[model samples]
Target chain A: MTRIVFLGWLKEMAGCAERQVELPSLATPEELIAFVAGDNQSLAEQLAEPSIRMIINKSVLAGKTLPDTIEEVAFMPPLSGG
Target chain B: MIKVQSDIFDPGAELNNFMQGRTDMGAVVSFTGHVRGQNDISALELEHYAEYTETEIGKIEIQAQRRWPGIHTHIIHRYGKMKPGEPIVFVAVCSAHRQDSFRAATFLMDSLKTRAPFWKKEISGDKGVWIEPKASDYAAEKQWTNKV
Candidate 1:
C-alpha cells in the first residue's frame, strides 16, 4: 500500500487530505492519480492541469521512476508562500 | 532553526534571538515576507503539510549549507490565517563574511518560495483565490540551478 497526499484546493476537491491505495506493482504515478480521481470527473480534470506539482519522497519530481519502497507522494498546486 | 507555527512573531525579536550567543558571526542578513495589501487583499490563509513543512524547509537549509560553507541558516514561517501587513515568513543567515551571508539568505528565500509545501490563498474582501508563483520567483530560483 502507498499513500498519496493532497494539499490546499486539491484537498478540498478530493474531499480528503490523504489516502492509501493498493495497486499493481507496475502501477505508475499517473495511474495512481487516475485511481484516486476515480469516478470524479472534475477531480480528474483538475489533476491533469499543467500547473500542478508532484513531490515523491520530499523532492519535487517532474517525471521519474517510482521506487517500490516509496511510502508517500504529494500532489500540490504551484507554491505561493515565501 | 526552522519553524512552522500559527502565532504572530516579531521579525526583529526573531532576528535578535537568532543573533544571540554569537560573537564569531560578522554578517547577518534577514528577510521578512509580509502579506501585501494591494488589490484589496485583506488577509492570507496559509496551508501546509503538518508533517512535511519543517522537513522540507530543512532540506532547503541543507542545500543552502552545501552551497555556502560556514553559513548558519534560520527559517520561520507562519501558517493559518494572517491579516494584511502581518509577517508571513522570516529567513536569516549568519556567516563570518558579508558575501556568504547575503547570498545564503537570498538563496534560502528563493528556494523556500518555490520548493516549500506552503500554499497561500489571498482573501480580497469576500473573494478568495489561490495565489500562484510569479515569473520573477522562478527566475530568481533559476540562478542556483548550475550549482551543485
Candidate 2:
C-alpha cells in the first residue's frame, strides 16, 4: 500500500489530508492522481492542475512512473511560502 | 541552523544569538517577514509537511552555504495560525564581507518563497483563501539564474 498525502487547497478538495491505498500496476503520477481522484470530478479537476507537484519518498518525483517500492506520495499545490 | 516551529520566536533574540562570538565574521545580514494586516485579513494560516518542509529548506541552506563558502546561515520559519503583524519568517547570514552575507540572505529568502513546501492561506473573518506565489516572487527567484 502506498501512503498518499495532500497539501494546501488539495487537502480541502480531497476532503482529507492523507490516506493509504494499493496502487495499480506501473502507476505513474497521472494514474495515481486518477486513482486518488476517483469519481469526484471537482477533486479530479483540481488534482489535474499543471502546477500540482508530486513528491515520492521525500524527493520530488520527476520521472513518469513511480518506483515499485514506494513509501509515500505527496500531492502539493504551488508553494507560497515566505 | 534551521528551525520550523509553530511557537512564536523573537527574531531579534535569534539574530543576537546567531551573531554571538562571531568576531571573525565582518558582515551580518538579517531579514524578518511579518504577516501583513491588510484587506481586513485577520490572520495567516501556514501549513507545512512536518519533516519534508525542513528537509527541503535544509537543502536550500546547504546550497547557499556551498555557493558562498565561509558563511554562517540561520533560517527560522513559523507554521500554524498567526495573527496579522506577527513574525512569519526570519533569515540571517554572517560572512567576512557584506556582499556574500547580503546575497546569501536574499537567496535564502527567495528560495524559501518559491521552493519551500509551506503553504499559506489568508484568513479574513469567516473566509480563508489559498494564495499562490506572485509573479514578482518568481521573477525575484529567477534573478539568481539571470532568467529575468
The most accurate candidate by DockQ is: 2
Native interface contact recovery, all models:
0.84, 0.90
DockQ of each: 0.74, 0.91
Interface RMSD of 2: 0.6
Error of 2 at B31 (Å): 0.1
Q: What's the C-alpha lDDT at position A17 in model 1?
A: 88
What TM-score does the predicted chain A of each candidate obtain versus native chain A? 0.79, 0.87
Q: Show model 1 residue runs off by greater than 4 Å.
A: A1-3, A19-26, A56-71
- Candidate 1 TM-score versus the reference: 0.88
Worst 10 residues of 1 chain A by lDDT: A23-32
- Which pairs of residues collide in model 1? none
Q: What is the lDDT of residue A52 in candidate 2?
A: 87
What DockQ score does model 2 reach against the true complex?
A: 0.91
